[model samples]
Structures are given as C-alpha cells and as structure tokens.
Target: MDEANRSDPPKWIQQHAVYQDLMHLDVGDSAQVYAFFLVYMDLTEGEEIAAVVGVSCPELQAVLLEGREKEGEPVQMIYPLPSHRSIKHRELRSILDRGAPMLLCAVASDSSLVYQTV
Candidate 1:
C-alpha cells in the first residue's frame, strides 16, 4: 500500500464503547457497510483530555473520499460528517485550530479506495 493510501483511524480514538466490548464492530447505511467506527472524542472526560486537530472542511471531505483519494482497498463510512452548526461547532473549530490530532471520519463511493490525509 502507498504510505498515503493508509486509512487507519487516528490512533487515539477507540472503537465505539459498545463495539469495543463486542469485538465485531461494523458501521453501515442502507446500501453499504463499514467494519470500523472511529471515536473522535470522549467529551465526558472534559476538554483538557480531548484530542483535537486543525482540520479544514475540504481536508475533511478528502478524509471521507468526497474529494481526492489514494488508491487501494475500499473504505466506506457508515456515518457522515456531523452538521457544523450551533455553539458546539464553534468550540470544535477552536480545538482543531490548536493543532490536536483528531480522528477525522469519512466514506467513499467504493469501500475499496484507500483514503489518505494529504
């Protein structure tokens, strides 16, 4: 695989708590399927412990394969981007600006395409 084509989730985010316990965690919508679910944050632990990233919207879409992509195994995401509205989004923006490593999530038309962080 090309170094740029790796789609491993960010190291920090754990599998969803329930999925972690169950071991077989899959995420899918009506037509497609995803085997992994990335956790972006543990908000209940409070802000000081969160892993944040300075990500742009286009960059995010790239992560999801809505933009450019690296070639390799198919990668599909069951969850779409969170709606960026309201005061909470403002705070999320601040976290990214601080240069924290965040679990950026996304999906592609083909599950086999390897998504990369440009």
Candidate 2:
C-alpha cells in the first residue's frame, strides 16, 4: 500500500487520549474522518468534499453521525476557516492556536496524498 494511504495513526497520536479515541472509531476510513472535519467545520459542502475524498456522501454522513454519538460535543470543536484560500495554512494555524487535535489531509509536494491527526 502507498505510505500516504496507510491507515495507522502516528506514534504521538496513538499515545494521546483524544486522538486515540478518534483513531479507534469505526468511522469509515481515515479519509472519511478528514472529510467529516471539512464538512463539520463548514469549510466545504459534504457532497463535494466527500467526492473529493473518494467517499460517498452517505458514508461521510454516517461517519459524522458516529463521531457525534461517540465524541459528543468535542467532535464539533473544529475551528472554522475564514476562507478556502490558503486553507491548509489557515487550518494549521487554527489548530495551533487552539492547541487541539485536528484531522488534516493534504497532497504533498511529491504528489502523495496523506491524511492524519494533528
């Protein structure tokens, strides 16, 4: 399998309680979880975002429901981005500013797509 597509959470995330609970969740795949954050944060619409992530809208919706049921209000803690432009940088800044765990997925310079918790 491609390294970028690997499903395992990073070492630090596995050691962190909040991220551990999230990683253990049977919420589709890691990409779906990232899609959930994108949708939940209102960064993008669910259908389009789901398509971009290669997950069906229903599947993404189910993941959202599962996260809500399992993580409760904490699942809704994503910081909203002010704009889609420079979204990744904005998201990283928001995550750092809040000092909270966040799901992030992106295409690297070498064209590898990666998804992980930060």
Candidate 3:
C-alpha cells in the first residue's frame, strides 16, 4: 500500500507502544486533535496552575484556540499526546467546562469540516 494508505495498528494494542511505532504510525484525520493541554493534570492541590500543557493534531485540521487564560491563569507544561486523538470529541470539551480535567488522548477540534467528515 502507499505510505499514506497503509493500514494502521489497532489503537488499543498500541496504547503503550514504543515511540518507534509512533513514528511509523499514520493516523487519519479522525484521529487528529487540535491541541493537547497536558497528560497528568491535577488541579486539586489549590488555586495553582501547571507548568506544562500541549496541543497537537494529526496531519491536518482547522481547529483554533480562543480566549487568553483569565487573569492569572496558571501556566502548565504541554506536550503532544504521543497518540492519535481518536477518543476525544465534543463531550470532552463539555467535561473541561465542568471542571473535570482529562488526559485527552485524541481530539479534532481544529477541523471545521470535522463534523461533516464524521
């Protein structure tokens, strides 16, 4: 098969696959996400923010981010989710709004065409 058309491994089987597999893996647009916040986010320790947060996408998407963190929003470290964000969806965003933090593994908020494609 052509490189882009090659079948990918099952998502569950590769959850903890090494980085090498990740490099070779090609997830489709559905698996792409706009951005990732962070992996181990824990906001229960006080009015504190994290040091790292990340945003990522598949090969393509039209997702956009809005609004600056409200006054004094804590900064956090961010890194790509290392996996195709096939699991995240509109529901995840709702969860975030409800103050439930998540380790969003996959999302495609950027692609305006995402709803149609799905």
Candidate 4:
C-alpha cells in the first residue's frame, strides 16, 4: 500500500480478522447493492463512526443505528479506513466531493455491499 493511500486504524481494530482482510481485500465491481444512502456524517464521538441526523435512506439508517434510536449514530469507529474491499478512502472521498465527510460502503459478512451512498 502506498503511504498516501494507507491509514493506521486503531490497534484494537487491527486485531480483528475482518479489518485485516478488508485492508487488502478486493471485490468485483458488479457487487450487489444491499442498501444505499445519502448521509451527513461526523467522527465526533471517540471511536464511533456515525452519520449525522437526516440520513436519507431509512434502510441504511436502520442498519447503522441498529435499533438504538436514542443512543445516536456511531456506526463503528475504525479510523482511516485506508481502503475498503473495493474502494479506497481517497476514491470514496472524491466521490463524496467533500473534504471531511466520507462515503461509507461496508461489505457485510454475507458478501453483500451495504451503505453505499453519495
């Protein structure tokens, strides 16, 4: 991985096999889209990777919130994603077209692509 393209996730996250695999994982472009969204997110809470209120897709909202409506959005705080199974953070960021907020497209364990929103 190039220095400019890779990011160091938290040590705890690095311990996870899923995270390790995703760091170098590759998936086909024709992946099935499970859900999509157009969310506004922030990394305020310590390790929680959450989107702001007004998430456009209710289905994606439900997945991220996971029935914790009042607790607030903290999807998961695995920082500096470096890259996802098929796309890199830089590429996603460019797609997002914003500097801070990111476009999150999580690959679920079932091999489905989730939370792909712009």
Off by over 4 Å in 4: 1-32, 35-84, 103-105, 111-118
lDDT of 3 by residue, 1-118 (tens): 1225434434653463332233343333323221212112222122233333222232223121222123456332222232333335664454344342333233223322211111
List TM-scores for all candidates, in order. Answer: 0.21, 0.28, 0.19, 0.23
TM-score of 4: 0.23
lDDT of 3 at 108: 29
Model 4 lDDT per residue over 70-99, tens place:
365433311122123454455544434422
- Candidate 2: what lDDT? 0.38
Score candidate 3 by lDDT. 0.30
Tens digits of per-residue lDDT for model 1, 18-39: 3343232222221211212221
User: How many pairs of residues collide in each model?
Assistant: 9, 0, 20, 1
RMSD of each: 15.1, 13.8, 12.5, 12.6
Q: How does each model score on lDDT?
A: 0.29, 0.38, 0.30, 0.31
Compare the candidates by TM-score and give the number of the best one.
Answer: 2
lDDT by residue (tens digit), candidate 2, 1-118: 2336545544664575543454456544454444344444333333312212211223222233112213233432232221221354653564445443555544332334444455
Q: lDDT of model 3 at residue 17?
A: 35
* Candidate 1 residue-wise lDDT at 28: 26
Q: How many clashing residue pairs, candidate 2? A: 0
